[model samples]
Target chain A: MAKRAAFDIPDGAYVNLGIGIPELVAKYVPEGREVVYHTENGLLGMGPSPADGEGDPELINAGKRQITAVPGASYFHHADSFVMIRGGHIDICVLGAMQVSETGDLANWSTGSPDAIPAVGGAMDLVAGANAIRVVTQHCTRDGQPKLVEACSYPLTGAGVVKRVYTDLAVVDISGDGFQLVELAPGIDFEHVRDLTAAELRPLPN
Target chain B: MIDKELPTAAEAVADVFDGATVMIGGFGEAGSPIELIHALIDQGASGLTVVNNNAGSGEVGLAALLKSGRVSKLICSYPRTAGSRVFPDLYRSGRIELELVPQGTLSERIRAGGAGIPAFFTPTAVGTPLQDGKETRTFDGRDYVMEHGLTADFALVKCSRADRHGNLVYNKTARNFGPVMATAATTTIVQASEIVDIGVLDPEAVVTPGIFVSRVVGVAEPALESELVARGVSYP
Candidate 1:
């Protein structure tokens, strides 16, 4: 799934990777494209995570995990980093999701459950400001419920902001027709993918 | 030459009185002025309005401060986290109030306050519940939300180093909101890892100019939660 997600990033694109699985996209930036990584905690040219015993305590990502910095790296205050995000400078943002709507609404920040912690760190800003947003998540919940829904029951991070959904099972694009099937995972058929998705699926012609 | 050095964290934050609006700089526990916060906790000032990125985490820092029942209100972005029990407990019981701002909006508001701008428009929370009561306007045919600049009576920040004049530099990501928070307050007190001579630091290396800082106290031992956690020390 990380390799599949890495294939979509264009060259020289400035990108922000959300915590969790999206962080893996940084490791698989296709070797040639100089994808500039941005962390909401105030780094511009971020490199990959450090190997064991090589980590720097102060130099970390938004996830609060230690990471390395690429050459030509520069730092700014938290405010300026958001300016890069909210001012429409970020080309792409890959985020994890609790649920994604057929209409491209993203509900990743919170589940709206009473006990859930509502930590909305830069999710709304990234969704509203980034040129494009892609969500990475499993096709089904741990309970086996579909995550691609007709409408998100959870509180939305942004309305109609998601451009694509990269699940472990399939790659779906939110379009005018809603939940267009872009590609399926290995050994998975259209019927199997459709059964796993709660939203309506429209397959594109060959 | 003007010297703004203070003897101790307690002395540095001694003037942060009750009911004061204080801006505590940090993203989680990174740039948090832990010593100053502990001093403030010892100072026992109640009904304080605190502004920060997160309410608190683990059981120390701002969380410990909030746990003391000193905070009456929290004006921040991400107010709740898994390990943040102080805020949730206080919030659920209605003992404390919250004005949850978007992270970007919070940063901009602080930056705008420091820049002397009254208010600005942002597209961040236009269609969400956060924008419900805010004044909205349109520019170039696109909708934007109005957010007022935020300032505080005192700002407590953490820095990697400081000069006698209070010029500051920060460690990597730990610099998060420290620079902006220092500027947005009437009295900015900094906790420095090392206090150097006036000519030791290059003018080009200074992130927060001395003009914005009112006090600087060198921590005998400068420790961050990330480092502490890495060392297997209990963070809270």
Candidate 2:
């Protein structure tokens, strides 16, 4: 499934996975691939998120939420950490988004929700500096609303920062013209997924 | 300029030009710099490039700057508090100015900046586009290359105490970026929870050498406000 491919992270990928859905990649990354996880608090080579009490008090993900560490993990001063990210040391960054425009404009940071809590940590650097930006999210928000829109009614996180998007139902690649449907979940129709999205989609050539 | 209350906070902040670079000290509510941040906010500054650990709750310290439209660009480790609530978006439709840095590298920049080194190399990003357009070499059968150090025009750091000479000490987790940011900024300004005499602070307890700090503004921060409101939970 295209959704599953998102977790098929390539080997030796120095990836920074965002919170929520993007965090799931740590659990199901294809075996035999040396995928390194980076957290903003200064940890790399992280393992899967531990079962509640199993997490180390010090180790965490990019979100600062408790996580697990694989062997050969190293810690360092965090100020130096940004130097690495801005210096473009990361191969891929998996982020979540509120909206992905037809032309690939991204709005993931601040939603239009008035009560939304305010913050912006290292997302700015990740979007601008990372080699490739992969977005992981449900096709539509939990409210049964389409997140892929003509324009983001919320706020923009990066301008065309997204290279590709993997949802629970489909795989989309944003390019010069608009979002191109690359793949879809097995048994899921292209129209249904396209219907769930407000943006226009062109089917990938067979 | 000289008053019992408003220390040289704003004037010292004057050199922080539009789009000036900065390294801040804070992690969530755990380690925010209260006075120095307020001094910058109160002065109505705009288009700052803040490099720090996190983008705390929007109404919290630096979050207020985002609301004030002063921060045009932000470079930090954790740009938003996760799984809690999304932050107040601060950019236009086509452009996103916030830049995310891996947490470890962010701290190292401050460490390197304060250490007076222009740049040092690390193999952390080898074989990826992250190594694009930079000097690289094979060292000891591995790739270890140079990553430049970051120094800001101004550093807004927080400390637990300060002496007349600007020597500072941090309490608990608040030390997260204070010591490093002091050295990372050309003109480092500090906000202390309390001001003691020069001889009061222990020489060993001074985390930031007074030589790196330019001015000290004294103020205490409020305790963490942990009122978590679950989203989409209907009132029954």
Docking quality band of candidate 1, CAPRI definitions: medium
* Pairs that collide, model 1: B59-B236, B60-B236
List chain A TM-scores, every candidate, in order.
0.96, 0.90
Worst 10 contiguous positions by lDDT, candidate 1 chain A: A110-119
Model 2 Cα lDDT, one tens digit per residue, A1-206: 22374465788888888877787777677768788888755567777767977754334455545566678976543454565576789888888888888867677666656454334456656675678888888889888999888777765655666778888889988888888998887789998988888978888777
Winning model by TM-score? 1
Error of 1 at A63 (Å): 1.4
Candidate 1 chain B weakest lDDT stretch, 10 residues: B227-236
Score each candidate by Cα lDDT: 0.88, 0.67
DockQ of candidate 1 is: 0.66
**Number of the top-ranking candidate, with lDDT as the measure:** 1
* lDDT, model 2: 0.67
User: After best superposition, candidate 2 residue A103: deviation in angstroms?
Assistant: 1.6
lDDT of 2 at A58: 36
Runs in model 2 lying further than 4 Å from the true structure = A1-7, A50-56, A113-117, B1-26, B29-179, B185-236
